[model samples]
Target: MDIRIKEAVDLFQEVMFYGTERVIKSIDDPLWKEFSPEQIQMLKLVSREKRITSSRLAALQAVHKSAISSRIKKLLQKDVIRFVQTEQQDRREKLVELTDRGKEVLVQSDKVLTDYIENLLAQHVNDEEIDQFLTIFRKLKDIIKADGVS
Candidate 1:
């Protein structure tokens, strides 16, 4: 294997693990105290999709339907998400959407994360470097998407 490829992969893994850990830690405010990391992740995914079927959400999260079901149940109890009946003929398929409260939570969590990232970058990285990183990241994302990796 090429040394550059190995190094890049190592760095990517390190960044993913370390950045996720730090971001989780940074959101330790009272407003976030009630949520688990997994719950927050689910909420984030739901927010992005606007509405998603439980099965599709499980697939996206690479988990079994039962696991997603448990989380969905909890979120439902909290009124963070609501199930909407799908128009499919089966009639059993339900799609999950964020409630107004869920949207508020997501917004607040995003602000907290944004502030953390902005502070971290401001302290260590310049604007030009950030722009360059974004350009490269987007290009890499496009390449991966083109390859049907997701």
Candidate 2:
């Protein structure tokens, strides 16, 4: 293995440890206590996409439809999201959209994530390093995708 790759992996592990801790703290904060990290991600996607099917969402998150549906049910119960019958020609297809409350939660979560990333980038890292990190990560993604993991 390349020494640089090993060093990068070490850096990633350290950042993940601290970053996840901070984000979990934010999650546990009262304003966000009701939502899980995955739920917030789904909510944000729904808020922007306007509406999406569980099948599409599951594909996006690389999860099974049943698992996505389970989370969707919780979101519905919390009034975080709503199911809409697409007023289209397809009568059997249903869509999920974020409720107003869901959007609000997503916005809050975005702020937390943004602040966390910003802080992490600003301290002990520069723009060049950040760009390199994203490039390397994207390359890794391409390699994995080429392996037909999805």
Instruction: Give the Cα lDDT of each candidate.
Output: 0.88, 0.82
Q: What does candidate 1's lDDT look like per residue over 25-140, in tens digits? A: 76668657777777888999999888899888889888999999999999899899998898789888789999999999888888888888898899999999999999999999
Q: What is the TM-score of each candidate against the true structure?
A: 0.88, 0.68
Q: Report lDDT (Cα) of residue 120, candidate 2.
A: 62
Residue 18 lDDT in candidate 1: 93
Candidate 1 total steric clashes:
0
Model 2 weakest 10-residue run by lDDT: 23-32
Stretches > 4 Å off in candidate 1: none
For candidate 2, write residues 48-108 as lDDT tens digits. 6789989989998789999898999999999989989989999899999887888777777
